[model samples]
Target chain A: MHRFANPARFLRIAKPLTPALFWLGLLLTLIACIWGLFFTPTERLMGDTVKILFVHVPSAWLGMGGWTGIAIASIVQLVWRHPLAGVAARAIAVPGATFAAICLITGSIWGRPTWGTWWVWDGRLTSMLVLFFLYLGYIALSNASSEKGDTSRVAAVFGVIGAVNIPIINRSVVWWESQHQKASITLGGSSIDTAYLVPLFIAVVGFSLLFGALVLMRMRTALAEMRIEARMRRMAQG
Target chain B: MPHAPFIIASFAVTGVFMTWLIVSSYLSMRRAEASADALREQS
Candidate 1:
């Protein structure tokens, strides 16, 4: 794990795998969307509104998963001083924010149909919204610091702090009054029928892989940019 | 399927925007990589 902490080694490993991940993710996402749109049975209660899960649930999960990765990378950067960890942490911030915002927006859209309201202060909905704000705050605070070390440390603290909300987001439906429904699918067991479950799983995998590819590409660019900045500073001093 | 059109529209919009985000980000990163390489060459 730490062996790949070196940017050069990480890049070499990721470069070969990037194309494969991108194509596989693209194929899977397309298949999942087609399966959901055409194959899955419409809900007895919500009718076609059920199909929203094909996109919303996976994007929500990816949003959480991406932030979890950033938090872990931040930890590695702070504790082990892994050189590429900061790059990875920085790389994931924007995508994670985008996914989280998408999750909230889609949820609201789905809500307007299913619950007859576009906004709610329910536990799950509110917490998920908070998570999006947290992502924005983390990105903003990181950029606020002029010193690189200060920026990384500030972001890392925010990253770790924000992570505590993930479990809360997951369990919010269980613990409190929620307009949001309980997860049809769970890690331990899924309540969703196989008809809906299969495509949902495919979407999850597709989104995860796509997120991985994006992170890798962004990290590589960040690493390169940092190197260039360092060289310029050295030249200026000389 | 009371509101199939609305749901489908939302999904299509999200899909198109997401695809754009991914492509634009990729292109931007590639451009940055090129710039970095050029900078390295000059040094």
Candidate 2:
């Protein structure tokens, strides 16, 4: 862990890994999308709108998963003082927020025909919205701290604190009697039938790989920027 | 049973956002690397 904290060493690993992840993710997602859109049978109850599940569920999962990445990176920064941890946390924020926003929009679109309402204050929906806001707040806090030359500890702390919402977002439907359906898939088992389940899993894996690629790309950028800043400081001192 | 528009819209939005993120990140990485290289040359 500590050895890889060196930006040059990390870049050596990431440079080769990024394109492979990106291409693999793109191919898998393309295959899954086509499979879901055409081959899968429509739900008897919801009809073709059920196809929306492929993108929506993955976006929602990655949204929360992104923050979980941030929380872990935060822990690394705070406890181990890993130099690259803050960069990793910062790198994860934008894509995470984008996915969170996608989840909300897609969920709303799915809601309209199914629930007969475009928006609702249900536990699942509202908590996910809160998660989106948390992402925005973390981004703002991170930028501000960087500009002020403060240690990223503020943003790191916020990342850890904001992680409290993840479980709430996950279990919201379970905890409250809401219009939103309870978890279709759980650790113990999934209620989804095989017809729908296969492609959905493929989509999730594809999207997760894409998400990983995006984070690594951004982390590389962050590392480069950090190196540039350190070089500038050294020149100034000399 | 004609919810095709909603499904299309969801996929379209996701594709657009994900593409934008990938392209933007790639461009930023290029710029950062360029600047860092220039700095290294100067030093």
Candidate 3:
């Protein structure tokens, strides 16, 4: 990780890696979604509504996964004072929020068909909604702090604190009796059938790759902006 | 495809959101890098 501490070295790898991840992710998404939507057999219980699983599951994973990233980045920023940590955390905010929203919207779409309703006050759903709102708050607060030029610590603290929601989100279904199904994929084995599981795994990987690429690109932009600011300050002194 | 609209809407929304997010991030990177270059030359 420290090897990438140098901006130029980071950019050298990121520039080439960005397009590779994007295109590969696009290909994988197309393949997995196509397979999941058209090739897989209709689920016995859920019928066609199960088709939403591909997108919904991946979106949900990334939604929570993104926050996990922010929390780690926040810790790095606070403890190691890694210069790019805040930038990476800030870069993660928008994509994280977007995925969280996608998860909710897609989940709601799936729920309407299966559960005969558009919304629920259930534990899994509500905790996810909380995460979405947390991302929104983090984005706003992070932006406000960065704009003022010296409040990254506040945002870092928020990232660290907000992580308390993640475990709740994960355990919500188990702790509370909700319409939401318990975990299908667990340490023992997946309850999901092989036909559905294969494509679902692919979709998760595809979405994750795309998420990684977006973060890299955003981090690049932040570094560039930092450069512009530094250069402008130097010119002003002259 | 019993509930075609629901499934379609799910895919559609995902497509739109991911496309917008990826495109905007790429464009911002391009713009920021360009600005950095221009500023570097000025200095």
Worst 10 residues of 1 chain A by lDDT: A141-150
Candidate 1 TM-score for chain A: 0.96
Q: In model 2, which runs have C-alpha deviations exceeding 4 angstroms?
A: A147-151
Q: What is the C-alpha lDDT of each candidate?
A: 0.84, 0.93, 0.93
**Number of clashing residue pairs in every model?**
0, 0, 0
Candidate 1: misplaced stretches above 4 Å?
none
lDDT of 2 at A225: 88
Q: What digit string (tens of lDDT, one per residue) describes model 2 on residues A1-238?
A: 9999988898999999999999999998999999999999979888889999999999999999999999999999999989889899999999999999999999999998899898999999999999999999999999985562364789999999999999999889989999899999999999998998999999999999999999999998988888899899999999
TM-score head-to-head 1 vs 3, winner: 3
Residues A82-195 of candidate 1: C-alpha lDDT, one tens digit per residue? 888887888899889888877887888888888999899989988888888888998898778656787888898889888999999989999997877787766689889899
Task: Evaluate model 1: give its TM-score.
Answer: 0.95
TM-score of chain A of 2: 0.97
- Give per-residue lDDT, candidate 1, residue B39: 88
Q: Is candidate 1 or candidate 2 better by DockQ?
A: 2
Q: What is each candidate's fraction of native interface contacts (fnat)?
A: 0.55, 0.78, 0.91
Tens digit per residue, CA lDDT, model 3, A99-203: 999999999999987999999999999999999999998988888854633678888899999999999999998999999999999889999999999999999
lDDT of 3 by residue, B1-43 (tens): 3688999999999999999999999999999999999988877
Q: Report the Cα lDDT for candidate 3.
A: 0.93
